[model samples]
Target: MPIHNADIIRIFEEIADLLEIQQANTFRIRAYRNAARTLQSMDKDVAVLVEQHADLTQLPTIGKDLAAKIEEIVHTGQCQALTKLRQQLPASLPELLKIPGLGPKRVHALYHELDIHTPEQLLRAARDGRILALHGFGQKTVDALVRSIESHIRQKPRLKLAEAAHYAKPLAHYLQQHPGVDEVTIAGSYRRGKDTVGDIDLLVSAADSQPVMAHFTHYDEVAKVQSSGRTRASVVLKCGLQVDLRVVAKPSFGAALHYFTGSRSHNIELRRRAQQRGLKLNEYGVFRGDTQVAGATEDSVFKAVGLPWIPPELRENQGEIAAAEAGELPNLIELRHLQGDLHAHTRASDGHASLETMAAVAKQKGLRYLAITEHSQRLTVTHGLNAEQLRRQIDQINALNDTLEGITLLKGIEVDILEDGSLDLPDEVLGQLDLVIAAIHSKFHLSRQLQTERIIRAMQRPHFSILAHPTGRLLEQRDAYDVDMPRVIREARQRGCYLELNAHPERLDLLDTHCRMAKAEGVLISINSDAHHPNDFDNLTYGIGQARRGWLEKEDVLNTRSLRQVKRLLTQTL
Candidate 1:
């Protein structure tokens, strides 16, 4: 029943999409989109803000009109404006937008021209050769759309890591506060910090099981109780995330945690090892011929098989066991080792916060430096800075740096990589900044060869320092554009340019496998927040999880270096 920030953002975004389809004022549609973005980056809950009598208008880019809508939605769970727009348009037409390669313009044309309102209709139209007759729809586009829509329908619901945490963390805390509950751990992919998770597995160690199960089933967010038992239960949260809880004795807690927080293959391999050692391992404990030898803790389970405790993120059966046995397991990079963020935005571009606010938050978070990478002129929708604007921002950063302490703001730009494989901004302008983060804003549907070459060519530019969101993926909404990443990684190594592991939850860009490849090629990765707001800096944890999954270490990350070292490395790229 609670209206979460995600809920509010979702509604606002739908309103924007519907407005766009209706050919409404560009500014009005953009206002809703901007407000949605502000909500997405906000750290606090909107309901809590309302409860605290906080002014919604105070939020960045949120105006009086948008604030009223937030209040309406938070209090009533629906927005009249959004409802009105839905009535004006075919309600099912919005569903079409979820399909990849189907944007507002394409959907609008399909709706008016073909009366296609759903994936079923669109698929039929495509099959009947009706879609290709539309202005922008071609045979390739039709084929891609059919594949995307079919795949979208077949895919199971999953939550991004950050989205899952919204439910998982609070639920864990709730269970921890229950009477007799001692320890609570969320296992499964959530513990492993997978980019996306199917469900949350909660393990609670308690003196009694009834209290834990009762408390979990009655939690405010439990929308449906799938199953309930004395020591175990399964429920679906209001946010549509399924949670399974198991109560275990304190002594068997670690074994349970290890078993539940597993990559199935990892557990299979561990069990095989235990069998070789003439021991048995499971959720309950480790046993030697029915005489319980170890299981009180995960360390004991691993120790019984002569191994050290492996971090959950690395428990993918991806050579982690062999590495642990050889004592070659990497001392994975932690959040504390990060010294700075090399890619961020401010009000100078599409980012919600100001330079001062972002810098202060970065400093507050213990960062020594934060780069202010505004979008370059090519990205007009973001109101990207031209040469003059960038020069002024660079000057502003310099002035701010002189007046500040503890944190230095680096001048930079997330310059667009033109289709012809050139940096968006001219070299003379780019030379004025501390770093240049090249990104692809348009033309995501390029061939793998061209896409890879486009990025590699951009990296060859003298001032290009890092590739932002190398794959340009938007989690569930879109797939990564075709690109030969191995070639890109190798090119980065040869060019002395770096690759970014974008920390933003929606775009944890460097795939784990790609991160591993980058590391092996001696190409350092910058685990940057690509932050648009101050709180966006908190997304670094997701990036850290991804880095660990990729087996990256402190030495392999770029921003983990001292400010001086980072500067030296950027110069090397130049």
Candidate 2:
């Protein structure tokens, strides 16, 4: 099987996890972690680059040694360094890292102190109160671990939408190249733009199922062919993503797509509506008694049900049917609807690109304005800006704006919202910017009431404009902090502040439900790229998907307004 970019990244991540567990060189461990992140964000396939003999070290954060390792993995399908580490560590030790609160340090301690190498053993230790005696494992920590372990055991693994797309797009394209394949569509939660996908459901229209099944099962990325038959095949990819392929006739393509791209609740309601009309709906077509009424296209299917075609993103049975019936479905937000980005980063903080580079990319992307919201001093790890640095940056932005055309740069800071509800920077310092984005960087484990109060207090600040990544959740990594978001949304409305839908793949915060809640409270959302590099601007596409899923309209988004209008709104809070 041909090694894929995702496959290489997975190996790097595992190597990093194992290295950390073995108390290896910190820099070596960090190199692997950084390499994995760099690969994950890349749109280009590293395997193809290796085949082209391209210099991988030219990529971000990739050193010559790491680049060689990547090339080795791409060609050999495994890394000898990772294999060596695996020899010294238990194979299941890295799996413990997936459980929240179990860092490498703690896992090391557990392994040496109690010989708990697997989750089952860890669970037994926790249950026996053995874990509580460890250096850092208190009763509360043990309880949390027990709960997390049980949840982990029960839940099937899911990939983030962006991660899933990394694997899905190439496979779909490969299928399209098949000789007899006419149409190929990816259904399931992926089609609905859900933040996470459990698996990929691919429906294809082909003249004969035999050729299609052969082509799919023989793909280079397939790690295992679980099943192969005339009309359907299921395969697990090297990256551990399961893909189910089904072949449908051209006449039934739309119906099959509709059936496969479903929330069960939405499908049930549609079937109920079909029943009311004395018709039967199935994967093949809509039938009135024995005669076919509609099936050629998705629009025809909806028309047969006496409704307009609802966008897949809103097919959650969440009042979408009612809205469609009333002809009141929103023209949901799209990537093109955005006029500007309200949050971005530069080399001034932890970001990788220069301010000019970021602005140029935004201009190329047809944006009217871009906010440079670098981290404030409280986040020292990012070399965050102190008062003097922020003042200098503000002046730099002012000078740059004077020379630039077609795109304006807005001065802003992602100032930390302290535990006591205080802004990281002084009011006088914050007052100088075009806007202020307050965020909770620490104290994530606070009580819900405290977390809510902390954010509300920040919103009360006159210069506060938006709450960046409002929930502070890193998808598939850390859960969202406990906060009364409904209360926060209402407070934001009262305070004339906005909230951000961070477009960064890992932190697509201000989730769909929160976006809807913000809309209900009349608070505008700023769907921002939170661009740290030029390529990062592309992440806005995911944000737009999330906005559409939330049923947001152009009007519900703050950056959809013109620059002047945005300026006016920014000043409202002040």
Candidate 3:
């Protein structure tokens, strides 16, 4: 636990990087960066000064406040201000500075103007000509960036859907407003609600293809116009997301959407259906021996193939064709079906907001209940709460619940499951809460059998409620640790506990496929936004998308139930 001068320098420099990304006051940002330099040059260690009760303010750029912060980091191996800023932004964002062309100002511009947050996003932008679109970046800069990101993400690809949407929505609206553009619909895997989209496909219907294509290629965010034609155009947004736009006639709009908004297998199955009926199905229209049969509506397209219109999320050909034939397509879970969020946080942990603020936002978001599941001790980096602090938080939640209306706060702890399969908090303390969300914060390198047993043993423990972020993956930043997922899902069924479909865009754990496995096993899944801030509750949208993709119905979702039902279910786990 020795806090070396290098440690202070690194922390100071990171503080500067984070502040620069936020576009914070220049002088304050420079002070941290300068102090990091000051420490780098100092012959003596700052730790020894703290040990000897020496005055740090005497050092250059080390004011009283910063000196105290350094002392805090030295003593506890953390700084409160640093921890708070990290919670406010994406944890991996500062790492972007490691890329060749990304300086602090460019980082701010990329984040504020484009919503680019990760090295993968940066890489995607560079390849798609987005980075070169910046005001000061040249081909040389973007080229180097491409090299860095390519090297950074050699093992990672595909930006998350939420990241893709940051670029897709605005561009769609931009084209929708152009005169003569009749309809604008985003298609492809984006339309299918896949967790990650390789690219965005957009379909537009208009009488004049020229103006539509012109508008699309000339979009303000376009980094490069790869191709342009009378009816089709391809461009890369500055954010590195590729968008393909096709301007079809109003007559072919529905069929175009159906064909373009497809999983290839699903489209093939539809073609087979049309061929069986002696018709042809294509993007232009459906025809029988060259006689137009259906061309104007999606329902018409489905009707031409003797089937009902299927929801885009279910168009993966995963029994949906047969399900539609039998009138058994699932009434998939929607955002509105959720009545509560079983996991969230407040400033008492690494979260940015207060308990009341998070509660108010949850109520605004139409939730009947919000579980304040702050991280328990063991995640020292998060300043996770200890037993006494947790007991105090329980009392605080009870007091707030008494005065609140329309929404209740459930007391819960996102306690870490130790490597040996023991819960971080004593069972006595954990038993007092309304729920316990057992999680694995470390030992990600454990063997598959060890990891699987670690989780199963935790589930078997008394009062274990939900297994949070079961695979412990962080999207592009990290891989899901080795574990036997089928055994984990099957074990949850026997333990009478539930699994969390963590809705954090970065960690949408319980992958859609695992969700189906759990559903088949009759284990209900709780789609909770492991929200650190109030705005994070919006992540539930992504969670619902994942659930629908997994073919989960409302009955299979834990938070979709009434609070009374949820409580009864929680009680059964005890």
Candidate 4:
């Protein structure tokens, strides 16, 4: 494979870890690690850098030796030094190094002195009294290592948006409390409203950089200050999450935030726009010459370059630039435009709230209508509703609607899509409900062709009103099963079924790319929170973000219609 910048950066990170295990020279090891971070964050492609400059050794933090090594790695599949080190060490050594508290010195001691190559081998050594016999490795150390390994194995790979928000909120508050700080904002993937975040980026505007930098190192949540300087600081939190903080003057703060909080592709498009207008843009500001044109606000910056202001959510560089220039960016769906939620659960399923409480909460949120979409009987573990129970629930909803002053409740069910591309509920039972959300809750490992066919078959059903979380992804936790999304959108449009832009931060399924593709196929989208509780309705902002990225207009989203219009559309579909 012809490696891209991201691929090369990952290789460098692995090389740095292996070098540390070998007890290589501290400066050389630091060089490789720094190079990896720098490459990962660079806005431009490394291949372009290599092509333009033969001596990458001349680049900052890269010398003649590392530069040559990078060039070789880019051209070929391997590096000589990395290959030689791997040959001398066990293949499992790299995996073992990922264990918390196991540094290069301890790893070398275990390999050379204890002959422990794998985590299993080390665990056995700890149990058999061999680890205690080694110098500097005592009983407490062995116990700690075992605990660390256990924690590592048990920990899930991803965190939900609500979960990540909890961590960022406190840190943002702490940074804003400093006297020198003028403003602080969280940027990057989180700011773009991604469901799960890998790391958090905080940008601050400061009257004085030194004091703010000093205060950042002393934050209570900070486990260790990784790096600090006059303009930037990086620290690892107690939760093992890394946070990067940058301080800039008030005048340049907006531009700096835009530059640092990027998906790289977004920034590239911005830079290209600047270049075409005979302007230069950087972290400082956009300038026509030495005189600054725009830097105080993102809108002003874009307008100065002859383009309309592109919303942050739409700044993913996926055709947004051209759309902005042409004055044709879609009027995206907004949170205030949603009149009802189509997917929600109560105590009838695994949800924590009851039907009455959920309905009350929805009314409080100013919603005109709400759907109680408990899981179907097939999901026994979730206490999904049986056919008889659904009848009772429908009566309850009708009674609630009669009693409630301004809000109406709809009878809804989240019917399961079976293995053979049929719904768990029969047509007669499904027809009795006001709304039906068909979802694939299991068998996600099916092949692309099979998965696409399976979903299409369900959409073909007359009672299947909406397809919930089309790809069934949980952000960093699970890769979406391969499905021909363009085809799905076409089928849904042809069959008058709605494609949901699920608002649960963890499952913003059918991501922005697929959403845009769906719109191109004339498929109407529904932005639903799939809320399990009242608080989950807050996640609607993320779904709006996804909708904006997809260039969704008011007409494109079904929820943007009035309650009467929506009800009429549903009747027409049936």
Candidate 5:
């Protein structure tokens, strides 16, 4: 019933997808897409802003027309334009957009040429060779389409961590507000800091389960109550995220949290250890010959097993138990450990905020330094900076640094790693900046060896500092490009550059496994927000989560260093 930021984002994005399918005006489609992006990167709720009568048009890429639509969505929970667009086209057409290679033009081509609409039709056409006959759908592409569809169909649906937060966080808070609730904690993959979550596991500890169960099932966001019981309920939220709530006895709360928050493999190993010790472990508590030993707290549960309490993020059966036994568990990096962000954007590129504004917000967020790394000119769609523009910006950064008090802006550019692995900008301009974050903007389908080589070549550049979003993945939308990540990590160590753990929710690149790989190779990772909006600095939270899951420590992250320390390190790369 309440309008959430995710709701608005979904509506606007759907509108864009539908419009693009209908072959609408390019700018119109872009307007909707950009508005959706602005909403995604922002920390504040648009509904709250609307309630305060804030000027929505002042939000980046939001115009008067889009503002009116936001208000409509808030008041009525629907968009009239999206409704009409659905009427004009098959509502199922938007599903085709989910196919990896199917952009609007391709979706339109498939629809008009092969009469494909839904994913089923598209899949059928691709398998039947109908898609390959279309203008741009080559044989290889058609083959890839079939595989992508098959994989997508077989894969379970999940929400990105940030999107799931939209549902889980608010729901947990709502449960906490109930009179009888003593404690509420979200468990499962959401608690484990996984990049994507299939469902949310909510555990409530209260003396009376009836009131809490009733409150949960009757919550406003519940689209349907699958089942309800005295102390448990299963419901699907309006956003298609499944949530299961269990009311645990106050004494078993920690055990319940441990059992439910498990990575099954980790729990299995723990149960095996308990068996060896002549103790039994389960959701209720640890027991020795029918006598309860430990269960009242997570720390107590771990103590019963002769292990220290492991952070939830590290409970993935990833050698964490062995490390705990050896007392070598990393003090995982936290959001507070960061002192600077090496890769970010401003209006000089596709970013929404100005340099000064971004600086102020970064300072307010406690970052001592923020790099303004505009996209290099090779990325024309973002109005990326040319050599001359970058030079002028370097001068601007120098002048601004002189007058600024708290946060210093570092001159940098996210130069594209071209197909042949050369840096997009020339050395003369790149050498003048404090740092250069080389990246790959296109050619995501290169062979694994080629992709790895391309990145290695880019990192070998004289002025290279970091590899931004090393894998070029957009969670749920696109898979990481085929590349040898371990080889790349070693290459980074050899070349004296670093890889970026891009913190954007959509692209938490450098998978947790890769983060561990980098750490082992003695390569520091710069956990950068890659912010396009001022508020996007909040994304550092997710970055820290991903880092902790990878078993990273404060020493493994580049941005944890003070400005003078970081500058000294950056100088080595240069």
Candidate 6:
């Protein structure tokens, strides 16, 4: 197979790890690490570099010494240095080094002391009482290692948008404070508001690259500085999070951010559209016959391409390009469009915010109404409301409604769906609520057929106004419980039950594709923040992105209307 830059970089990184474990020369190992990163980030293929450039040594960070090795590896499948290192260290040792908090030094110690070379072997040792006896390793360390192993095994591979935002916000703040940084914003999956993020991307506009690069390396949150250069820097935080920062001049900042923040598919579609008009779209700027036509803002770039500006969420290239070309893109729902939050919580449930405080915060956000959708009695962990508690909450909500100035508090419950497809509360209890959000809280591992049936059955209930967090996914933590989404959408649409676009970053449950699918089926989608606290209301943007990606119009969303209109829709469904 022809080798790619990505493959070669992976090999070099493994070699560097093995070398470190072997206690090789520090500079030699660092050279390999540097070369690996440089290759990984390059736009061109490593094999192409060797084929086109006679002196591959000219490549950044790849001096004559590293160049020869790279050339050998590209032409052949392996390199002598790497092969020799593998011989000195079991190949499995390099894999072990990937575990968080376990580096080459620890790997070396574990290998020599306990003959541990694989995760399975290490786990066995930890469980069988072999790890604690080793020098510098103890009972606490063994227990932690075991827990890490279990977490690694159970954890989902993606990160929720909320979790991603947690990382992006701090980094963006840090970059903005840097002396040379003119402006900074998060881009990519984080910007689009996907439930899970593969990596956190940041774009910075700087007067000079040197100061920005200096500040990136010295950031306090950075656990390790991975790579730093004139135009870009990549770092790994203490939380095992990866952040890439790109610096561009003010003139090119917008275009660069747009290009780099792309889903590759979106960028390709944009370039293809530009090509049809005899123009070129790239990171630096959009060009027509060597003249820079658009370089500053994303809107100009789209105009230069002869299309109306598409929102970031709808930029996934899934019919969006065609829609933009035809000027048929939907007027995607916006945060300002929301008249109220239909599913929120207060201290009555697991919510930290009080009923009065939650209502006041919603009003502060310009909402005309807010629903206090505390958990039903099923979720004891969240202090779910029982009959007595529900009555008390109803009274409090009524009192708050009377006293509140700008917002009305609606009595609501996020009632759990039992295994047999029944609500946690009886029909009498459910009938008393102004809004009821039916959700599946347990038995997530049920078969797709059963899970879909479970949710579809809940939607059949006249009292169930909304289906909350349809997928039950925690970004970077768990996969969506298996469910027949198409069937669920069809059934929900048929029954007039709204499918929720949960705004929680960790659970943007109605993902873009699902949202599009639901829209296609004529299902009404509700973009809800599902805010547990006031600050979480910010996540509404993520939900809006999903709605936009689905090509949802203002009319398609139930919450986009005024408070009276929303209440009317809810009543009609009831």
- Per lDDT, the best of the predicted structures is 5
lDDT of 2 by residue, 71-165 (tens): 89888888898899899989999889888778899999999989989989999999999998889788877888898899888879999898898
Ranked by lDDT, the better of candidates 2 and 5 is: 5
Give the Cα lDDT of each candidate. Answer: 0.90, 0.90, 0.86, 0.78, 0.90, 0.78
The residue pairs that clash in candidate 1, if any, are none
Q: lDDT tens digits, residues 1-574, model 5?
A: 8888899999999998888888888789888988988888776678999999999999988999999999999999999998998898887888777767778899888877777788887788888888777898788778888999998888898889998898898899999999899999999999999999999999999999999999999999999999999988999998888999999888888888999999999999999999999999998899999898988789998999999999999999989999998999999998999999998898888888888999999999999999999999989988999998998899988998999998889989999999999999999888898899998989888889899888888888899999999888898787788898888888888988899999999998879999999999999999999888887899999999999998999999999999999999999999
Estimate the TM-score for candidate 4: 0.72
Residue 411, model 2: lDDT of 92
Return the top candidate by TM-score. 5
Arranged by TM-score, best first: 5, 1, 2, 3, 4, 6
What are the per-residue Cα lDDT tens digits for candidate 4 across 380-472? 867888888888888888887788877788788999998788998888888888878999888776778999999998888878888989998
* lDDT, residue 102, candidate 6: 68
| TM per prediction | 0.97, 0.96, 0.76, 0.72, 0.98, 0.70
Model 2 vs. true fold: TM: 0.96
For model 1, the superposed segments whose C-alpha errors exceed 4 Å read none
Question: Which residue pairs collide, candidate 3?
Answer: 125-240, 130-238
Sorting all predicted structures by lDDT, with the top scorer first, yields 5, 2, 1, 3, 6, 4
Candidate 3 overall Cα lDDT vs. reference?
A: 0.86
Better of 1 and 3 by lDDT: 1
The TM-score of predicted model 3 comes to 0.76
